[model samples]
Target: MDAAVLITIVVMTALAFDFTNGFHDTANAMATSIATGALRPRAAVALSAVLNLLGAFLSVEVAKTISGGIVDESQISPAVIFGGLAGAILWNLLTWYVGLPSSSSHALFGGLIGAAWISFGADSVHLTKIVEKILLPALAAPLIAGLVGFIATWITYRITRGVPDRLVTKGFRFGQIASASLVSLAHGTNDAQKTMGVITLTLISAGHLSPGSGPPVWVIVSAGTAIALGTYLGGWRITHTLGKGLTKLEAPQGFAAQTSAATVILTSSHLGFALSTTHVCSGGIIGAGLGGRERDVRWSVARRMAVAWVLTVPAAAVVGAIAGKAASLGTGGVIGVAVVGIAVAVGIYLASRRTPVGPAHVVDELYTPAEPTPARKVA
Candidate 1:
């Protein structure tokens, strides 16, 4: 392929990944609200999509970090970036299918690292930068958010213990509306920038712009729009998992969880840490579940989500490596990889149609926890 054509391909794939990121993480903002009836499923996603677009303009700090900090752009080709994006997109779809709340951020990082490593060797990988920006945040951000959420949940319950149940529920339901919207805005600020950064990096590597350049205005608009559109589509599977699977969410816990997640994500974005909003929000939701004394936290489902989190980076990296190796063969090889990617994506979509999860089913299927095991009969 011509250099221009290749660059265009990579840029479009990056946007596709952004789309996946939006829907995959939509539950981060709207899941609890939807579960608690603070917002209807359609209204929740529509509002989240709008706020996500608005949040994109909040900061360029995370974008700058991604474009310049994580990898040596000069050492790699546009094909490498394309392969990385393919890996991330594939992982996103797979996890979405299984209703696992994995980290799209790590999937992107792993794909980039895997591709760059295969193409240029370990020297192309920025170990120090990865440690500071990606790895550390991956470990710390969630724990911090979890701890904050746990405390907030505990306090909420203790403070409201003797209060009238009706007033408490009504107050928090109203509060959830605000906090969830903020989380959506915070998500856009952090996650949308990942695509912007990738596009900017691709432009730099292609010599379309100098290294360390901010995303072009066109890049910003396109990325924001793509993510917003994806958010509107909604990721119903994961929404069910987070909203109702982990624990039965009520308005107060949902409100606390969103507030805690928003604080962590927005703070990290301002500090230029490309942390996973999915991780932070998931942890917050789990914490919220733990807060409700009568609520049962489903450890099995939580474990499944955790396992997916542990695997996302390596799994995406493996796919990225294979794609990178093929693309390195030639332009034809790049095209071949794209063909396979499209095929796999189509397959997933077709399979999804058999048992589609939509707004109509979001509440009834997800929020209704499994019935408790039958009481043991006398032996």
Candidate 2:
């Protein structure tokens, strides 16, 4: 394959992953709103999709972080990046199928590191930048967001304790609409930019763009549109998990969760931390559960989600390493990797048809008795 053709393939694959990121994460922002009836399903996703598209343009800090900071572009070829993206897109789709709200950001990072390490060597990877930009944020963002959500949810109920319960519910249901929309925007600002960064990094490595250059306007537009379209499609499986599985979302809890997640995500974006919206939002959901009452948290589902979180990076990394090795051989190597990626994707899609997790049955089928077991402790 021509290098230009390979670059185009990489860009398209990145966008495809972005689209999955959008729908897979729609639940991260709007699921609570929908569950609490703050907004209708269609209306909520539409609003989120639009705001997500708008949010993509708000900051290039994170994009720069990915394009130049994570790995040395000079050390890895665009083919390696493509293999990495393939790993990411696969993991995202797999998790989405199972309705686990894992971190797409981590998946991407894992894929990139895995591919780079396999193709070049450990020396090609930027460990310090990874620690500063990716690792530290992964450990901190969710905890901080959870604490904020717990406090906010507790306060939301405590202050309204005197008011009629029905009145409070009605009022906060309205408020959740705005809060969830903000979270969606924040999600766009952070999550969508990762794909833009990856695609731009691919271009830079291919020598199509100058080193240290920002993502081009077309990259932004395509990424934004891809994610928005994915959002419009919606991810019912994860939405069911967040909105109803982890805990039943009431109006007040929904409002508090969305508000806390938005604050954490927007703050991280400003600081150029490409934190996972999935992690932050999951923390908010758990916090809402805890804040609603003593021991209200569903430790079981939480455990399962936690396991998924722990495994995501390593799992994606392994797959990326395999693909990157295949891609190292040359043009034939690149085509071989692309073929396997497409084959895996098509196979997953076909298998999904038997027990489809679409918008129609997402809510009803999600949180069913058969979902994975949640973890209780780190050990």
Candidate 3:
């Protein structure tokens, strides 16, 4: 009922969403390294976690875009924001259970937009900014990363041709150490800022901060810590999909993919485009798969991922709208949404245990390619 209490509740929910963002997108940075044996599963996540935390402090421009650019903060309340977060978290959980590396960024944007729009109207949203910043980048970032990854991988294989296989593997595995670390850092730079923006936006809506103000020191630290902790937990299901289900990646290819993803992510962060690290990294992984002479890309797995990507925004938006409508009611509405969210979350967790894919499973799948499939052809 109180504004202060509502703001605190929304802020905590924002952090919880950040934690999901961390583990959900962990595959973007560490999947390939784990697959190629460049780092052990536990060690890879630990390294990525530390880098992600450090990266969160590197930029806040993206946060500014979220807090000020996307939606009209003056027209909405923290209740709408909480509804948006609820929708995003539910989408994130569903995708993770299915091992689909969908865009957590899009889910967040969709939820926020949907909730805000429902709470007020179209006037409450910045249509032009959403198109110019969020939508355009979402469409283009992956294609660009995929192209860069393909070219890089092709050149890597050709340049290292005729070298001893063992030597090539060893050399690139070492390179993967640096490249993957960079990707993890880039992820923190971009993704962590999304949650920061949400929290900052919540605070502003609650009249705790002025419009256009940046996230304070405490906000930044708490967000970074939440995501870092989630990264350590590891999203092995999605990691397995990227590292093993899509294609059988060589050490050199892994190095190229990570490098390409890092380049795109850091560039977008600097420009303050709210890019999806998951899309960029998935594209890079798929591109690297096709770039090799072997052409190990599995079209089926890719097709499935595409379906999930296309559905992320609209699906999350619908759920966000529903939640926002409910939350607009009052305290009882907020309690209802929380109960439903918790029930669904617990259900997904319980369902996932039936077919657990942990670090051990991912490590095992690394060396074993799916049923004898021909090169340069869909499997």
TM-scores for all candidates: the values are 0.91, 0.90, 0.91
Q: What is the per-residue lDDT of model 1 for residues 201-317, given as tens digits with 9 covering 90 to 100?
A: 789888999976888889888888989988988898889888988888878898888888988887776776646788889888887787777656889998898788888877888
How far is 234's C-alpha from truth in model 1 (Å)?
0.6
- Using TM-score as the yardstick, the better of models 2 and 3 is 3
Give the per-residue lDDT digits (tens) of candidate 2, residues 136-253.
7767877888899889998998899889988998999988888888888877887788888888878888888898888889999999999999888788778878888888777888
RMSD, candidate 2, Å:
4.9
Off by over 4 Å in 3: 60-62, 67-70, 126-130, 210-213, 271-274, 366-379
For residues 241-360, what per-residue lDDT tens digits would candidate 3 score against the true structure? Answer: 999989889999999999999888878767766467888898899889989779899889889998888888777778888898888887788778888988998999887776667787
- What 10-residue stretch in candidate 1 is worst by lDDT? 370-379
Model 1 RMSD vs true structure: 5.5
The clash number for model 3 is 0
